[model samples]
Target: MIVAPYMLKAFLCSVGLTWMRSRSPGAGISRSWARALPCKPSPAGVAAVVGTAAVPPCCFLQQGQLSLRGGLRVPPCAFSTLGWWMVGIPPDTAGTSSVGLRAERSPVFACSPMDLSELLKEGTKESHDRAENTQFVKDFLKGRIKKELFKLATVALYFTYSALEEEMDHNKDNPLFAPLYFPVELHRREALAKDLKYFYGEDWKEKIQCSEATQQYVDRIHHVGQHEPELLVAHAYTRYMGDLSGGQVLKKVAQRALKLPSTEEGIQFYVFDNISNAQQFKQLYRARMNALDLDKNTKERIVEEANKAFRFNMQVFDELDKVGRSLGEEAQDGGVPVHDGKGDIRKCPYYADKLGTAGPSCPFHAAVGLARQPLVQLVLAACMAVAAGAAAWYIL
Candidate 1:
């Protein structure tokens, strides 16, 4: 049967994903256990040994050949990237060695256990703190931002979590997702929906719109779900973990700043109803992540994807900051641009000094003159305080 490239890619990716998940911690069998089983070289030499009979035609056409783990002499095209992520392809000299092709076992998987959760925490600590200390974020934390701006931030989050949760549900049956699929425990879509109603009122769905940054973030989650669903693991780790950790702090800040009632009305998005102990739950979540049957390359890719997820969030913050700034400006007034095309969040005087970059010039003088107005002065003071605090935050 003829298949389009996208479909073929998706099919292969799914197969690979399934194959890898089948070896996860709770999955019936594991690689170490399977290695002890008896096996025979294929009659067709290396090709037959690798289960070439059940292999699809696309595998042969797209890739050269499949090499058995033992010493089977097959073509170079043992697996495509999709399959590569699924079933590991033997090295080039796999079968040529006197000992046949042996699956490359990761030290973390076999010998030294690695705490993926701790690694993520340590790897992302700086960026995570920086994001929290951004001028826009500090304004919200200090309750200095307007209710409308705060609502807008929630709106953006609504779009993002919607995409992520929907994709997770769609791919839940996949083995790679089985261990991590805690819809009751980690799902935030319904909570975010409640927040949207509280902020935008009953007609929230009709009125809410995504910013360009929010849309980009949504598109990225969808793209990964469609093409490389395995990477969703990383996205989940980046977002949900952050939500469970720093999100708790932000929840308290928001409730106080927004004067939200001590109920689920406004802060529903941050509440974890099923999880009584956030720290304990986080440990469980990390255990599932570390238990995933990912090879070294796949693990590396997951880490990279997590980093990308953080960068995506920073971009969303940048977009939100622009919207907040635009709230006070005159029709033709152009405020100082903060972000460059690159994803650097600390590009302005406030953040630049924090990052040790020379501060930008005084283009905001014209804008500051308008701040002399009564109502504008209050906001300007808050902005200046937020900026100075954010800059100093990096120093200390």
Candidate 2:
């Protein structure tokens, strides 16, 4: 029987995602199954079948042959055309490979069971989500940030990065952490100092003191750098990669929210002068991290430490949230408003929460309520009636 092309594509994508997900820590897939599937199906090959580009590299169709790990090969035409070549292979003839291809079992193309970058990403995903959803981060994203709170947040970052960079400097030469060190590209302490100077003037150093939460985070960084130097990789990866990922977006939000100057003064901490291409630099950094000489246990510990770093950040955010509550100042106005392109005001989380509340905060709801008033309704109805009568007279 001929298998439909879409069916074959779906099967391949399912296999690809399964292999990719199984590589994460605590994935329930059996070790033998993971070894059998090998590297994720290459995006090009999967895209050729599925019409979307995603998934990491490994099995791919080259020239005319589809090459997968474990020495399994199939012609591109097998799935491209409607044929039984793919589906007709007997189960008994299929060897170690799961896709019914004869397994030749070569060791040359074998991939490591885990990469440090993927491990940290998957393991700390929950912690990252919690940190992002915290009230401070959510408010900042919505441009509801007060200038005072923003400056205090900058102060916290200055202290955190100062400690992190100091530790990174001491471990820069060590074999365990050396590959990941990129002072010019990734360090933010100097940039943060510039931001503080802009916000608090030349006496910024004396005006800003580390908050209790921030001090705890700094102490942890120092402790990790001094005693468990190898685990410093966790803090570096967590902070620098996260900053690189979200820095520009946050910078734009802060600039608009606080009405900061266009010269990039107060938001200097988010600007990476040395790194021209953040994406390529991040890929290079992850590659270097994967190349490190580390065992499974060490890698697990590093993932745990990265989660700890995320926790420390969340604690700092909580402290900022508490401080924001006590301040009498209103959140800055004239900030850029968030739009989801649907134009429905209720869709915005910030506006949705304030929708029916009394005040000028929700003008849309106020207008809606006014339209429902008997006097306003009567006036609107009279206007519509007059316009209809005028149209009728014109037609006559």
Best model per TM-score: 2
Candidate 1: tens digits of C-alpha lDDT, residues 1-396: 232344445545544555555555334244244333333222343222222221211112232343333343223211212222112222232222222223331111111224455455556666666665666765543435556777888898889888998899888766565557767777888898899898888999999898898898899999998888878998888777667765665565566556678775788987877655454355445645654556677777776777777778778877778878888732221222232212223321111213223233244744654544444544444555555555555655
**Candidate 1's TM-score:** 0.54
Q: Candidate 1: where are CA atoms >4 Å away? A: 1-113, 328-396
Which pairs clash (backbone N, Cα, C closer than 3 Å) in model 1?
A: 46-72, 64-77, 65-77, 69-101, 70-101, 71-100
Worst 10 residues of 1 by lDDT: 50-59
> What is the C-alpha lDDT profile of model 2 across 273-355, one tens digit per residue?
76554543554456456656688999999999988988888899899999998988774754334322222232121112222
Root-mean-square deviation of candidate 2: 16.5
Q: How much does candidate 2 score in TM-score?
A: 0.60
Q: Residue 192: error of model 1 in Å?
A: 1.1
